[model samples]
Target: MIYFFKLIRWKNLLLIILAQLLIKYALLEPLKVDYGLDTALTPLGFILLVIATISIAAAGYIINDIEDVEADTINKPDSVIIGKQISEKSATNLFIILNIIGVVSGFLISRAVDKSAFFVLFIITSGLLYLYSTYLKRITLIGNIVIAGLVSLSILLVGIFDLIPVISDSNKSSQLFFLSLIKDYAIFAFMINLLRELVKDIEDTDGDYKMNIQSMPILLGRSRATKLVFILSLIPLMIIVFYLSNNLYKQPMAIGYVLILIVAPMIYSTIKLFNATHKKDYKHISTVLKLIMLTGVLSLLLFQFILLK
Candidate 1:
């Protein structure tokens, strides 16, 4: 049971759920807006959306593991499960089941919102994850972009599910406000995941090289790839700094938090990245990126105090 959960990366799934919950309660629910949702249906609606996101994400993990078995044998041998602890056949079964559950949940939610047409988002999301694992991931940098796009979609999924259906003459302003907020979150997700995915490519360059996976690291060489990742990692930091300079410079605590916890560490990571040549070095750098991602997401909380003032 533990292995199964680990295999599907339940931790990350939980993070996705938490992100959605924070968006709802911390950000949206408090706003003086209709939100296009009945207060009565809010909890159950959120739960269904959370379940659907987890199912699709879990299915993605299963197929990625199945497709990357050989690559994992090189990069993460001890953790590969498709043909060792669980058979490939069983993994495929789990994939189908997860997709079914995800799509069904979306279907039900669509009906509840009177937006049955939006169910296609679920179907398209599942199919794309499958395609990513099976083919797109083997192509090269394009795979990273695809997965990053999907991560952004997860943030937007909540808006599509809960806020869109209620848009009308009266609630249009409220709906637009939520949509803008969701868009900000989605862009944050994209930037963080794009950075992480590039780091992962560098981390797995060895396995990817042997498997002819055509990853950025394999095509660009580790030295260049690390440089590229370091360059890319600075993007969000610079953006945030500028954004805060204009937006949060008036707020001492929020600006301090970004400078110390977010910006400073990222600068250190870039320096560490340049000296990192060994696989273990790349591994640590990858972990640093993961922490940065968490810090980025948690920055949403700063909005609370910012909004209060």
Candidate 2:
């Protein structure tokens, strides 16, 4: 059971659940009350949506682990689970089961909202995750970008389901306004996750090389890859500064929160990435990026402060 939880990356699945809950409750709920913004998901339906997203994500993790067993044995042999703790066959079965649950639940939620077309997103995401594990993981940069876009998509899914379905000609402008806010957060997720993915590539370069998997770190050398990632890391800082100047300048509390929690750590991470050499250093930077992603998501809670007042 413990190994199973680790295989599915329960902690990451929890983060996904938390982010979705925050989107519906902290962000959209406040706006709905203060601004009369319409939302589509009922509590029960929202639960289904979370289930669908995490199930697919869990499946993705499992399949990725299965495919990377050789790499894992080299990269972090002690942490490898697919062959020792969990059989490859069992892991494959679990992946299939999770994908079914995810896609079917997605179909149900899409139908519930009278948008059956939205069901395709789940199928496509599941397919992409599978392809990424098997084929795309071998490519340079493409795999990282694909995974990062999927991370952003998870956040944007909330806006597509909750905000878009309810948009009317009367409230189209206001609906789009809130959706744009969600989109901004999605973009933030993309940037942070992209950096993290690149950092992971650098960290796993030895293992990836053994498997003939090419990455930025492998192709350009770790020093060059780290330099590129360090440059990319600054993009989020610029976006946050622009966002603060244009949107949150008046809200001192909000600006302070972004600076202290999100922006400061990002700066620290970039500096660390610049100096990073050992695998442990890259791992630490990856962890910091994950925390920044969490803080960025949690920033949605501040919307209650900004919108209600």
User: lDDT tens digits, residues 1-309, model 2?
Assistant: 999999999988888888899999998887775687899999989999999999999999999999999999999999999989999999999999999999999999999888999999999999999999999989998999999999899999999999889999888888899899889988988999999999999999999999999999999999999999999899888988898989888999999999999989999999999899999999999999999988988888898878777
- Kindly list the per-residue Cα lDDT of model 1 for residues 152-214, writing each as its tens digit: 898888777767776777777767776787887788788878888888888898898887789
lDDT of 2: 0.93
TM-score of candidate 2 against the unseen true structure = 0.99
* Model 1 weakest 10-residue run by lDDT: 32-41
Give the clashing residue pairs of candidate 2, or none. Answer: none
For all predicted structures, in order, the TM-scores are: 0.93, 0.99
lDDT of each: 0.81, 0.93
* RMSD to truth, every model: 2.1, 0.8
**Candidate closest to the true structure, highest lDDT:** 2
Error of 2 at 59 (Å): 0.3
